[model samples]
Target chain A: MGMLIIIDQPPYGTWAGREALDMAFALAAFDQPTSLLFTGAGVNWLRKAQDTADIEQKSLEKNLAAAPIFGIEAILADRTACQRYNLNSEAMIDGVQLTNASADLLGQYSQTAFAG
Target chain B: MNQLHTLHILNKTPDHPRFSECLGTLGPDDAVALTENGVLGLVASKALGLVQTYALESDLSARGLSDDNLEAATIDYSELVNLTLQAERVISW
Candidate 1:
């Protein structure tokens, strides 16, 4: 298993931002140690409430809630992104650790994959 | 070649600066995987020229990109997976 990093989010709109997390889960299924970093509008994915019934998409909240079970311990959220979006940490998905997008966090991985 | 050790996976369109910017940084030995929106580069190979490109077969077909348009580089899913294994590192954008 290799380092699997995902950053799936756009500046404004749709579900493309969730692709990174989906890929991360797929990678985890292969026994890879996965990490996720949400930035820009991607941070909205972590917000506590999400319902896909309207668009006929599967519940996104259901998918994100399983990260811990998949062995993904690191879920980094950009502090600036949260501020820009006016999203509070308390409203984020459970088990996700929020933090700034620091060099140390980014450099820790060998490869960085963006899903935007 | 030692330069081929790094495989850069690009998922944006040719219009994306990341495509040009990433290409400029690539050594002659690097291999590129055109997936998602990056397949647009294949459509304009005449101007972009040939620089060792490969399109994810599944993605290209899913997006309705035919072989005729993929004059630059085209490969199947197995080839894409194999390239990743051959690479010392895989960077996706």
Candidate 2:
């Protein structure tokens, strides 16, 4: 069974979300099956276009795009959250699946993690 | 009577010392939900792996955060209430 890493915070405001991503990648690198689930403001990381130059922070899109190479294949977002923020597949970086946010959906995982 | 699971509600950032102190007290059968600013702790520590963790949807929106990047399940107020009802005890930190 794979581990689910749920991120709910936006990037750049604090290093927490980005750090969480790092942790996920670390787990994946160690050969642990890992999946990323984004909802709420965390979806912002998947925006197709982001301007981080003003903040002097490197864009997270490139790292996110490279997630597959690190063995993270299943990336999902909450459908309601995506709709609330007006984010669709076209507006997001490649490889994100939108899913219905239901208790049953979450129950599918044997272990769950939260890093906002 | 069978003992019910403890529901721990954390409402502070992970850096807060209480966050870890509070987490240290949880048992394997307990459940945890992060609300208010406590949601920040999700990334603050790997201790969350000790128990199932959940995040509040409204709080995340208020903070301009989406679950898109979060590692916690997003639940609404109704779900929160349900969780509370299912637990044998509730504690907030």
Off by over 4 Å in 1: A1-4, A8-15, B1-93
Top candidate on lDDT is 2
Number of the top-ranking candidate, with TM-score as the measure: 2
Q: What is the DockQ of each candidate?
A: 0.02, 0.03
Chain A vs. true chain A, TM-score per candidate?
A: 0.82, 0.93
Docking class of 2: incorrect
Model 2 agreement with the true structure over B1-93: per-residue lDDT tens digits: 334489899986654577788898998788889886676565445678777889987655544345447668889878999989989899988
For residues B35-91, what per-residue lDDT tens digits would candidate 1 score against the true structure?
755664564335345357787665544333443434556777788899899888889
- Tell me the interface RMSD of every candidate, in Å: 12.7, 9.5
Q: How many residue-pair clashes does candidate 2 contain?
A: 23
Please report how far candidate 2 places residue A65 from its true position, in Å.
1.0
